[model samples]
Target: MVYSHSQVQLYKQCELRYAYKYIDRIPVPAEASLHLALGTSVHGALEFLYKEVQRLKVPSKESILEEYHSIRNEQITKIQEENKRSQLDQQQVADFAHMGVEYINWYYSTYHPFDQSIVMSTEEKVFPKLDDDIKFRWQIDRIDTQDDTFTIVDYKTSKRYPKDTDETFKDQINLYGRAIKQNYGSKFKKLIAKIVYLHLRNEIAREVTDEEMEKTRIKYSSIIQEIIKKTQRRSNGDKEAFKPVQWYRCDSCPFKMICPLFAHNYIHDEAVNLDDMKPTTIKAVIDEMAQMAYEIKRLKEQKDSYAKILGNYAAEKGYKRLYGNENKVIIGKSENYSPLPEKKNELESKLASENMLDDVVDIDRFKLTKKFKEHELDYDQYQDLVKKSVSITAQRPSKLKEKEIDEYMDIIGEE
Candidate 1:
């Protein structure tokens, strides 16, 4: 199984999507949103700036902006050529590109001298195996040393700043800091992590204590264990290994056409099968899939999305289905749901008396939690329902901690 904050977070958000992406190796939509474009261009510009600064020369602000423009323009062209985005038009793309440029310019003005620390590496790959079955990799954006402290700097370009209290971002820095500590133990007396908000022209820095690093390792190891357990169960013919957590996120998933819940009504049997596909058949099918992905993205972006308006309206009218150009939209609610909290105990007792307790509930913790909310269950009720459902996850020391792993080599010492 693959491991990264993004991948693990995706599994946590929707395991079915994870299976589609990692297990099935589905090709994601080629057209990126403007937000992604900004991050990519900014990251490229900063990588250039740091690499240049480390060589004992700081480029003029104009020169740095010029590099940013080149990157943003090239990326915009690539995005336009892909024609994968439905919500973003050409003008919006240009505007987002300009926004990135402005942010980079602001970044330059804020850090004009570029003398805070010596940049050791940018976009360095860190492949640290957690355990035998939990091997994975990640990339550190930047690592710089100043005095006794080594700073793991991550450049974040976004309209909104990352929440300082968010564990995801915190864990992200920890992952980088731990990697640095493991590989460059003798080089620095202390290690700290910084998330540079390029858009805001400020950073949120923190010291990733040894305790936090160890906790993060255990936390990450547990997620990997759950993923491994699900995969093993799935291979042994457990069809329930990955279950849907439907929401707006589904609107962005590329494999929606073939996703079990939506496929029967939304897709034809003629959809591409990558396993048996020939080179000649790839382009046309993938292009079509991208179009469908764009359509879904567009619908979701609309103020009155189809899922809400059409599906709900049709269901209200007691219509089982509605027709579009060549597809049928299934209008219905899911079945086998638990009762509302106020009535849950009574219903549970009834089911138990009828010998239907196990057959009546989905029993998956996350799934049950979501189901509980949809049924208007109280918070305490949801907690009670899920108390016994939390699965235990096994943990282990990373291969690096045990000195049974590959070394970072030149990345740790590169100038």
Candidate 2:
């Protein structure tokens, strides 16, 4: 499959959206914004600045600002014409245009004369093949060369600057570095990747090594393989293969009305003002259930908080049972075991070899403990089969007969 970094990121963000876009070939209307116009204008002005430098000509800061303003206004006019309900008013559009001009002026001042390196290309598109069938198609924002070393530079207009240790930006530049090496390996001696944050007026850079590139290749190749396999499964009648991953981006997603994960929310929202034709409405029931669920969650948090306090108090006092006026709280220990999924098959196989898999469901710890109590296995054998940990729990006994409480207390004492 021919993919780009953005396409791969979209797949990782939400499989259902990727399927709707790439697999189903669904067309979504584009929404225009002043922010996008500002970003595009800044990129265009910088491209003009660097391209002029390649010709032994350095454009003045005012000229670059003019280019930025022209680009911004053209886009803003188109956006207003197409999107009547656009949230960008005249003031917002003017502010964004001014911001674009500032970004261009800042960038031009920082890299004046533009002679640090030779410009190889701006907005160059490349197709790099990982294998015979797996390929990537992406665009490099800019490439510069200095003494056999190549630098891949990407422009960012985001308000939030990336941290020094941000892996996402690093991975993107690393991938671009690999593309350059693949295309011009004979001419390249070293690689450097950078993301220039025009808004924040700072940049993050990395020196790329061959070893890191290989690791990145393997990582993304594995993810692409998984996407392919899941796509095939989804095509072959497995409806659950590509499930929706609801996240912050869902609000801006055009496919949310059809996504199984959030379609019900849209339905409920639309039905909130329906006429009350019956004594009990479905919306009312759903609202009540939602409230109940919230209440249950709140109460669970409170109960867990109290349980922790009670458990700690009992431990400090060396008391297994704390008596209240109407109820008694018991502090006890329970054994728990949870085997990793990959280790389950080997564990079950070992148990079957010893003829101890009978009546055991999914390696249930309680059933295994019962078998141990019945003397079906020795202490060492049971311990080997399941590693157990004891956790203290606080339980309150209320509305219980004295005889029932005595029996429960006796059982706990014996254990």
Each prediction's TM-score versus the true structure? 0.62, 0.69
**Tens digit per residue, CA lDDT, model 1, 243-353:** 878777776678766777545334222434576565444335645566776777677789357577987788678888898898887776766854788998999899999
Q: List per-prediction Cα lDDT, in the order shown.
A: 0.74, 0.78
Model 1 Cα shift for residue 196 (angstroms): 1.1
Residues 1-105, candidate 2: write the lDDT tens digits: 798887788888998998899888789866567788887888888888888887889889988888887888788778877787655577877788778877877
Off by over 4 Å in 1: 84-88, 267-415
Which pairs clash in the backbone of model 2?
none
Where is the poorest 10-residue window by lDDT in model 1?
397-406
Query: Per-prediction RMSD in angstroms?
Result: 17.7, 14.0
Give the Cα-based TM-score of candidate 2 against the true structure: 0.69
